[model samples]
Target: MTWLLVIAGAAVGAPLRYLTDRFVQARHDTAFPWGTLTANVLGSLLLGVLTGAATLGDHRLHLLIGTGLCGALTTYSTFSYETLQLVGVGARLYALINLALTLTSGLGAFSVGHAVAQAMST
Candidate 1:
């Protein structure tokens, strides 16, 4: 049952990731991967919120949202590859910006999500 639930969540998340990536990438003319960054940060926030909610209730919720949906939605490999591409193409500054913004904002969003969840639970 757990596996089934996770699989279902992934089924939704993976396509959503693809669509979102394409949509965001299309709107921007720059080399920076706004799509991937957006997905990663959103996934991190959602995972943090789900994990926080698990503290107040069911573990299955975390398994479904955090482990399943987020797992498929965010791609560390794509982030790494894009960063490398930026370096290889001489956009070193963009690479660093992407790295810094993604990391900092992801953590910031996650913290906010966790706090929201905690507040809701209390």
Candidate 2:
């Protein structure tokens, strides 16, 4: 039953990640991988919320959304690849910017999400 929940969530998250990446990437002309960054940050935010909610005794939600949805939605591999690609192509500055921005924004967004969930539970 738990596995089914995860699978169901992933079924939605994986495609959503792909579509989101494509949509955001399409609008940008730079090679900075806005699409991947956007997906990862969004996933982090959602996972944060789910995690906070889980602390309030919603383990199923955490399993379905956090472990499953976020697992598929966030692309650490792609982020790493893109960063390395930037360095390989002499876009070291962009790589650094991407790294810094993703870390700061991802953590920031997660904090915000967790706060939101906590407040909502209260």
Candidate 3:
């Protein structure tokens, strides 16, 4: 049952990740990897919310959304590859910017999500 929940979530998350990446990247003309950043930041926020709401005692929710969905939705490998690609192509500034923005934005989004979830639970 637990595994099934995780599988179901990943089934949705994987395609969603791909579609979202394509959608966001299509609108941008830069090598900044906006699509990857968006997906990661969104995943972090959702994980934070799930963690914050742990008191709700829904283990299935954790396994499904947190483990499966977030695991598939966020792509650290792609982020690293893109960053390295930027550096290899002499776009070091863009690489740095991507790193900085991804870190800060992901953290900020997670914090906000956690706070929101905590408040809602209370």
The 0-to-1 C-alpha lDDT of every candidate, in the order given, reads 0.88, 0.91, 0.91
RMSD (Cα, Å) of model 1:
1.1
TM-score of each: 0.94, 0.94, 0.95
lDDT of 2 at 32: 91
Off by over 4 Å in 3: none
Candidate 2 lDDT over 1-122, as tens digits, reads 99988998898899989999999999999999999999999999998888767668667877788878999999889999999999999999999999999999999989999899899988
- Determine which window of 10 residues in candidate 3 has minimal summed lDDT: 50-59
The total number of steric clashes, by the backbone 3 Å criterion, in model 3 comes to: 0
Score candidate 3 by lDDT: 0.91
Tell me the lDDT of model 1 at 84. Answer: 98
Q: What is the per-residue lDDT of model 3 for residues 22-55, given as tens digits with 9 covering 90 to 100?
A: 9999999987899999999999999989888899
> Distance (Å) between predicted and true CA of 85, model 1?
0.6
Worst lDDT window (10 residues) for model 1? 54-63
Per-residue lDDT for 1-122 in model 1, tens only?
A: 89987887798889978888999999999999999999998898988788767767676776677778999998899999999999999999999999999899989988988889889999
Best-performing candidate as measured by TM-score: 3
Off by over 4 Å in 2: none
